[model samples]
Target: MTVKQLSMPDLVDACVQLDIGHVGLWREPVRAYGLEATAKLVRDAGLTVTTLCRGGFLTAIDPAERAGALADNRRAIDEAATLGTDTLVLVSGGLPPGSKDLRGARERIADALAELGPYAERHGVRLAIEPLHPMYAADRCVVSTLTQALDLAERFPAHQVGVTVDTYHLWWDDQAPPQIARAGAAGRIHIFQLADWTTPLPEGVLDGRGQIGDGSIDMREWKGYVEAAGYTGPIEVELFNEGLWARDGREVLAETARRFVRHVIA
Candidate 1:
């Protein structure tokens, strides 16, 4: 589960009480709780750390800014290593402020990955470039498609750099199926998250995620595609909707469990 709406302890408790085998954690809560403490907590509970939420945003024009981003990612890599998870999700930063050079932004990502790839390998961590939907291309994430994520990942060994497949971000992409197969073949499909798409998006479009099977996307097809591509990892249910987060976290977790079986695993 993402740590955006719950304290780390609450998150861990809910997961344990529900017998959740794996969880995806964000960096902020992990830091706030004391990295070692949080890691130990999850370890003692016997839950697998699925993937660290993020470690990218490396697309910057300013040299200092770029350097700072790389340094931060190094720390993130160290954190993932400490947490006993090899996958560190990377959301390549969006366009530089007031700039329209999308190509330049993508190129900068390649450069940054060239530098950070070795660092991640040394830490025994794999960097997964998560391409946000095209809607987030300007403000949140520049890598906007699975193909693009794979392209960046292909530049490095699969073990060092990989890609994340989030159904919410990729359901609209017609090209995603072939790329998913390719990612699996190359051993670069590091993490898979499920979030259904819904309309009437909230402002900023960041927190409008829907629950599984509640939207238009065919989740069974998504699961079939990924499985056909040879991905047999934990399928994380990630929701960012404000409405959902406002409800009881345990209720949300219970419903998520129901939907995962009904819609994703069926």
Candidate 2:
């Protein structure tokens, strides 16, 4: 959510003005604006909904908690189908309360996927499992590498489940490139996202993603990796920086587009 500060209508207008034909939407804003209405808004603007951000967090030791997670994901799937986007990026959950079992936690995610994957497929959607950085392992996601994500995704059909190759999280791993190739060979690289890692991460590391070209990542290099892997889908720029948010949303959107051209496209 690079321009999370912008209202849905304003964001839509910005995209149209900037000739941004496709958008990756987050669930909160879409739900707040009314799902059907958002679907109509984007549809009427002739903008494609690229992918729905997040329908995971399946790790839970408690039975009721696990059921709630699955139910929420089902709603997310329905929302994705309603929004006409086939990809649902998942941030599989972390360890449950007082639990130190990482392996057990991941297994729960697989169990949830087994139930959710077919439901998603029935709605013309695919579940894209996104592995967060290892730093997020304890409380955000246990799948912290492309290899781990692929291990989970391979259990299901490629069309029903796949992995999200996000530069922000995977850039640190030397093994990611080969994993990208592996994912591509199986047609499981569902979506590719770009975000730069900046130094001196803020207290809230979640919002520390930097603007393209403003950090250490070679955006074009990562782009090349995904392309070499035969991922021809939309390349989404998803930043989470509070600094950018404090600035003008429209201006940030325009700037991000320019940065994409400079750092990724060129």
Best by TM-score: 2
Steric overlap count per candidate: 0, 0
Model 1, residue pairs in steric clash: none
**Alpha carbon deviation, residue 253, candidate 2 (Å):** 0.3
lDDT of each: 0.89, 0.95
TM-score quality measure for candidate 2: 0.99
> Model 1, range 36-141, lDDT digits (tens) per residue?
9999999998989989988888888999999999999999999999999989999999999989998899989999899889999998899999999999999879
lDDT of 2 at 124: 99
Model 1 alpha-carbon miss at residue 249, Å: 0.8
RMSD (CA, Å), each prediction: 1.1, 0.5
**TM-score for all predictions?**
0.97, 0.99
In terms of lDDT, the poorest run of 10 residues in model 1 is: 1-10
